[model samples]
Target: MLSQVIRYDGSMTSPSESAPLDGDELETWSALATVLEWLPPVLDVQLQDGWNLTHFEFGVLYALATAEGRSLPMSTLAGFANSTLSRLSRAVVRLEKRDWVRRSTDPEDRRVTIAWLTDSGAEVVASAAPAHADLVRRLVFDSLSAEQAMTLREISRSIAAAISDEGGWRPGR
Candidate 1:
């Protein structure tokens, strides 16, 4: 539930950007905002309950699992996981404690650190993937028509491009 709404009161408007959202635009933004607010915790619950991992941890593990040789440089992993290096580093530290991931300085370039998914990490990812996929399908795909799904993909890509251009990570970059 959206607990608070600071509706436009015309108190801080400029000449060029003075107009508040139109009715259709307001409704669209509200729905999108609600989804943004709501989706993560739902995804988190499945990962936490079934695999004892947070969504970001699963993303890190999944990203490494799909990378060549089950590893990536720290910066590259952070990009793919759509996280900052510091955040990724903290998650990597937690995964290391579980012996699910390991970090090593690159043999040739000493400054570059690499994260590798251990065999144990692979096992956890393999175990969790299907259930995660099923939940996603049930919650998202099942609710959308094919055309709507395609539209969603395009919209997501456009939004991703815009956000990435503003200095956010773009997966597959």
Candidate 2:
């Protein structure tokens, strides 16, 4: 059983000494906080150390790989990668320098620029994918039973919806 602790005047107090919260509500909030604290660094280390890519860089490559024609408009790519345009521009410049991505004006709209993953970028992503998948499996999926995994997926979807309804951050929006 989980017990609640209350903080009062810089001291910790028992739940009985404090006003109540809905149990499920409290659990949901706590779980979200805990996961946020843990998940990012775990993902970052795998991307940074193993793949020589930052989390955002990995996201960009992954998004391009899954996108139509392995490309997207720079604006859309920024949104998909949850980065500001300037930041994405810098990242794309870096990738361009490495010959991993190419930038070009959209054929139908010269004013718009598109980012396309080069063959080298695709190869890098392919090489990194297995290690990334292994990390995800180890850090997340392997710990849960099949039923629990399904439940987690449902719960995460519901929470994501609630967060989005509240105007929370959304990539590719």
Q: Could you say which candidate leads in TM-score?
A: 1
Q: What lDDT tens digits, residue by residue, belong to model 1 across residues 1-173? A: 43343323323334444467879999999999999999899999999999899999999999999999999999999888877788899999999999999999999999999999999999999999999999889988999999999999999999877765655444433
- Give each model's whole-structure lDDT: 0.88, 0.84
Model 1 CA lDDT for position 120: 98
TM-score of each: 0.86, 0.78
Scored by lDDT, the top model is 1
Could you tell me the TM-score of candidate 1? 0.86
Kindly report which residue stretches of model 2 are placed more than 4 angstroms away from their true locations once superposed.
1-24, 170-173
Lowest lDDT block of 10, candidate 2? 2-11
The root-mean-square deviation over C-alpha atoms between each candidate and the true structure, in angstroms, is 6.0, 7.6
